[model samples]
Target: MKKPFAIVFLLILSSCQYFEKQVPDEEALLQKRLKEINWKEVSSYPSIAECDAILDKELKKQCFFESMARLVQEKLDLDTIAMLYPEMDTINVQVTVYPDASLKFEPQMPPDNTVSYNTIAIDSILKARLVDFPKIEPAQKEGVPVTTQFILPVILDVE
Candidate 1:
C-alpha cells in the first residue's frame, strides 16, 4: 500500500506540465489585431468648427461635406471657368487632407483625352479660388491623425 501511494504521488507531480497554460505571443497577438482593423475607414472624419458640435457621426460627416461643396461652388462661381468652357457643368475636385492639417486641391481630368478643357488652367484656378477656408481638423484613426483624400463634385451654376 505504501509503494502504491508513493508511485501515485510521483505520477501526479510529473504530469503537472499538462495543466500549465501557455502564454500567447504579444507580437503575434498585435499582428492579428492590426489585421482585424479596417485601415480604409477613419474613426473620425475631418471637420470644421460648425460641425464640431454635432454628436452623430454620419450627420457630422454630411455637414462637413455639404459645407465644403457649398464653399467650393461659391468660390468657383466667381471664376471665369463657365465663360471659358460653356459646355462644362461640373468639375470633380480631389481634396487631400494631410495629417498635419494641410490641404491640397487638384482637378481630376476627364478620362477622355480628346476633351478640349485645359487641365493646367483648371488646376491653377482650383488652387487659387479654394483658399482662405476655415480651419479644418484632420481626420483621426485609432486616436491618431491620418491623411484622407476624397473627390468632391462641384457644380458650376454661373448663370
Candidate 2:
C-alpha cells in the first residue's frame, strides 16, 4: 500500500509540468502586434472646428482636406504667386500636422524638371500667406497623437 501511494505521488508531481503554462515573452508579443498594425493610416485625421461635427470617418477626413485646401487657396490668392508663375495653374502643397497641433506647409515641386520655379521664393510666400489659420486638432493613431503629412492641390484662381 505504501509503495503504491509513493509511486502515485511521484507520478502526480512529474505530470504537473504538463499543466504549467509557458509564459510568453512580452517584447516578442509586442513586436508581433506592432507588425500587424497598418502604419500608413491614422485612427483619426487632423481637423478644424468646422469638421468636428462630422461623424463618418471618411467624410470627416474629406472635410478636413477640402477645408484646408480652400483656406490655402484663399490665402495664396492674396499673394503674387499667380503673377510670378503664370504658366502654373495649380500648385501641390505638402501640409504637415505635428503632434503638438502646429502646421507646416511646403510647396511640392513638379515631377518633371522641365517645369522650373523658384522653390525658395514659393516657400517664403507660402509661409507668409498661410499663417493665422484656424486652429487644427492633431491627428491620432491608436488614440495617441501623431504627425501626419499629405499633399493638397491648390488652384491659383487669383484672377
TM-scores vs. true structure, each candidate: 0.83, 0.82
lDDT of 1 by residue, 111-131 (tens): 866668898999889889999
Model 1 vs. true fold: TM: 0.83
lDDT of 2: 0.94
Q: Give the clashing residue pairs of candidate 2, or none.
A: none
The C-alpha lDDT values of all candidates are: 0.91, 0.94
Candidate 2, 1-159: lDDT as tens digits? 999999999999999998898888999999999999899899999999999999999999999999999999999999899999888889999999999999999999788678789999999999989999899999999999999999999999757
Off by over 4 Å in 1: 1-22
Candidate 2 ranges beyond 4 A from true positions: 1-19, 112-115
**Number of the top TM-score candidate:** 1
